[model samples]
Target: QGTRELVGKVAEALASLPPVTVYEPEYVPKPPVVDTSEPLDIQRLDDGHTWLIQGPWLQRLMANVNFDDYESRMWFDKTLRESGLYQQLEERGIEDGDTVSLDGYEFEYQY
Candidate 1:
């Protein structure tokens, strides 16, 4: 059948079918909250400039960083600086200019 004829036949068939009823769910007041604060691991690499940081929260956070955008990169840096991870890494001998590897991405550590 031609395109227009086929479309018209399909439309007619659909028009003869019963109408659909959409189900609406009730509103939920609040969602259950679970603690996600887990410990992180910092391992020094032999390269002397690279360290591996592993943890669920760190992994999830690192996944959101967009290195190509200056604002996004800056926000990630600021967030790290405000968190305990920065101090912990420093305590673990992470120096300025060192690389921090997380979630398959590498970031430079700066004071």
Candidate 2:
């Protein structure tokens, strides 16, 4: 019968379809040798800012100043300026207006 033939053809067509495949990614392990013995380089800049550098890492600290209020801004600036870290950076050749680079990125202390 034509219906039986058609059914056979349909079943054959479905059987001819490619098999479905699921991919699983291979895991890669991290290297065993990593160096962390070197000391980090610290820099202090004028304007109550500090910069710390280690290898490709860098940290910058800036005073939190309230820009909308003049008095709050003044207080924040004064507090940061008196910080020992800020003063040390100033003594270590980082000028008040200097840009520092870490991990290929440049940063400056700006309020």
Q: Pick the candidate with the highest TM-score.
A: 1
Clashes of each: 0, 1
For each candidate, what is the lDDT?
Answer: 0.75, 0.49
Give candidate 1 regions above 4 Å deviation. Answer: 1-36
Q: What does candidate 2 score in Cα RMSD to the true structure? A: 16.1
Backbone clash total for model 1 is: 0
lDDT (tens digit, per residue) of candidate 1 on 13-104: 99999999998997633322222367778888898889988888766666666689676667677666666778888888888899988878
Q: What does candidate 2's lDDT look like per residue over 52-83, in tens digits?
A: 44342112222233347666546544644544
lDDT of 2 at 89: 54
Tell me the lDDT of candidate 2: 0.49
